[model samples]
Target: MSHVNAALTPRARLKIGRLIVEQGWSVARAAERFDVSWPTANRWAQRYRECGPAGMTDRSSRPHHQPTKTPQPTVRKIVHLRWKQRLGPVAIADKVGVAASTVHAVLTRCRLNRLSHVDRATGEPIRRYEHDHPGSMLHVDVKKLGNVPDGGGWRYVGRQQGNKNRSDTSGKAGNSHHNPKMGTAFVHTVIDDCSRVAYAEIHDDETALTAVAVLRNAVAWFAARGVTTERVLSDNGSCYKSHLWRDTCAELGIVHKRTRPYRPQTNGKIERFHRTLAQGWAFRRFYNSETVRRKALPAWLHEYNHHRPHTAIGKIPPISRLTNVPGQYN
Candidate 1:
């Protein structure tokens, strides 16, 4: 049956008719060989006599008229709204009073709705991404910054304000003999797993109080930009395990997760951030003094969050890539 249907095509019908005439094969034999009905073979032969090979050509299978179809004007409107106004199919459908699916189909057919995405935080254009909806998991983690030079030999730009009585002297002690002001500052940091937007701060200590403060600061920073801290992963450090940190998470209604003992890679977001920070900011240039390095931290962080383009987040800045802004980080 299938073979007979295929033989009805113009090319096959024309070939079969020609073979029947040339080989002088009977209609029944020709029909049997070609696997076509006898009537079909006879009709094809007659068509060949009257109109030659052209008459044996197959006709289109599509119906001549489409009674229930989207109007041409509506399709044109869909394409125009998508292209000129940059409206998505759903929005366009709402405005034009049509089914969203219909608008999508029309826009797809016109190939006019495929617009590139732009990172909202960084204000940079981004390639199209597959994960366009919400409820997608985004991870976060913090890293303690290592003692290193800031950049451009700016290690000692800012004044060191310690205990009023404390002082330092290179030869021995600058002002106070009991306490020196030089030490490694911990960098409290967080990173988004999906967008790779990192929030980091340098602090004189990594105590539980400082950890809570940094986490609060990071939350506020992300909140201002509309990125939510869905879940935060961290190491099992004393500061991270502190009650203050736990209370802060509870207050913010965020989940605080810790990595396995001796396995920092389990919270790799901030780990990767630490590596980038070291390479891009810490080791990017030389520094003259720790004060200068500490002072330059904020500017470096700003650059990292707002100016430095990321390869993973469609080359967009972290601020541009964030989407939700439910409430203030406060």
Candidate 2:
């Protein structure tokens, strides 16, 4: 592609070259006609004579030779520090005896400038994988969210008011006596690998029974939409490791896969979906009570599945991936 500020496109350059070379127009006359400098016109004419029309296309701005460029050994060392040590540009610069800017430029050229793009454990670029079909794999996880107090939380109300509400609710009867707090909502989420279609429910606990129930409902939900659950991936949480979860998966005919210990990236789809749920639904608006916030989940989920554009899936809603299902658009 031509640079944004380029005065002439390849076709226009070709026209200029043809006028000056084939038509025998004077360089000055061609420059005046084309509103280009005489040197620019003459350069194109010479290129056309030597290389023909092919030379009219934009060439790379990178010079053929960089004499003062950092040595290959230094470049390798910089990459080594990034991969093995997981060091930032400034830290690598300090170790390599070079300027941080030079290290940054090298890292950028190597596509290692952003640490988020690299795996935390391996320090290598993350290899993202998605199943070819929607039902081939499912990512399941639970997100713990603080329950909103009556009359809203600190986000909308002042901290003083929020603290008072917390104190009032902390020791109330019918709440957890063992650990008295405002209580947490366990958001059980299931998301497909390829389509990113998601199913979630807010539960009081992330126990084995609750997880099994959520998995059953999620499977049925996806089956209703013409997706069969072949595999399910989750972290090594106690609920996922329980006999109940194992028996449930066996009954559902799903291959249960667990992430490697301390490796949450294996179930990253549901992890990322929880972040979206928090931002788009849970914390997006102030609620008078926890019940009010809980009521908003289904509407937000419907919008996410049927209306919101997902970046990973070509900017279309998740339901678009279920092409075999009728009334998907509706």
Candidate 3:
């Protein structure tokens, strides 16, 4: 495989090769058109001539031989011990009479390093998918963030002060998920699969009513920009499964889809958004008060949707994926 900093991908190399080898283009012409160096173009041309299409594919750079590698019989013994005893590298090393590192290397090469990978209880690997159109599917989820106190709390002060803050706040807050007077706030999030356009609002509670309201607002927000929401993807939380939430989806002409039990990856988009939200908003600043922090969400959201580059969609802002919009930023 090409290194991370490699100048061209396999397809680009193939295209360059096709232009030079098949179309009788000059090397200088191929290099100029592909925006690659002459040496690079020559190398690609040579590789393509030698192996045709197969040469364009990434190949392992591992050496042809390893003199220090474990012997085949020893490797077989290591594998046998790992399977029969279900032990880790350290334990297997003692039994197989090899270094722990060597056992680990053998296990890794054999694809038996992690027992969880082969365990029946772990389930099959998840197949990631994305909706083809904007608003075709929106991943919805809620994340709870503890309200930051006045002038900030532990994050600002020392650990001792943080412990004191925790003790002081624990006595005042209500309900099961305890915290100080800052109280937990729920961030209801909605993100479109195709464009990665996101909507979020912090509310006091996460309920069927709150979920329904957020969906309505998000749909309206998308509608203004000409993206008609066609479906919603959510985890099977109590609020998501509520009849009110169902009726809300029906009224909006959206098909509501839920992730499989305990399989949150099905709704991975919003889950990933929650991580970004935490870093960009909840933890980005030392808010003097929860109210002040709440006010900052709109600005941060604007930056995310209109300014920040998203990797999945070619490092462009999510709004750029919307149709009929001119370039708004570099």
Using TM-score as the measure, the top candidate is 2
lDDT of 1 by residue, 200-238 (tens): 777768888887887778777766765566667778888
Ranking by lDDT: 2, 3, 1
The lowest-lDDT stretch of 10 consecutive residues in candidate 3 is 118-127
TM-score to native of every candidate shown: 0.47, 0.91, 0.63
- Candidate 2 lDDT by residue in tens digits, 190-308: 99998999899999999999999999999999998788899999999999999999999999999999899998887887888988998999989889889899999999999999999
List, in order, the clash count of every candidate structure. Answer: 21, 0, 2
The segments of candidate 1 whose C-alpha lies over 4 angstroms from its true place after superposition are 1-181, 323-330
What's model 3's TM-score?
A: 0.63
* Per-candidate RMSD, Å: 21.0, 2.9, 9.6
Ranking by TM-score: 2, 3, 1
Candidate 3, residue 11: Cα displacement in angstroms equals: 22
- In model 2, what are the clashing residue pairs, if there are any? none
Best by lDDT: 2
Off by over 4 Å in 2: 1-7, 169-171, 174-180, 324-330
What TM-score would you give candidate 2 relative to the actual structure?
0.91
RMSD of 3: 9.6
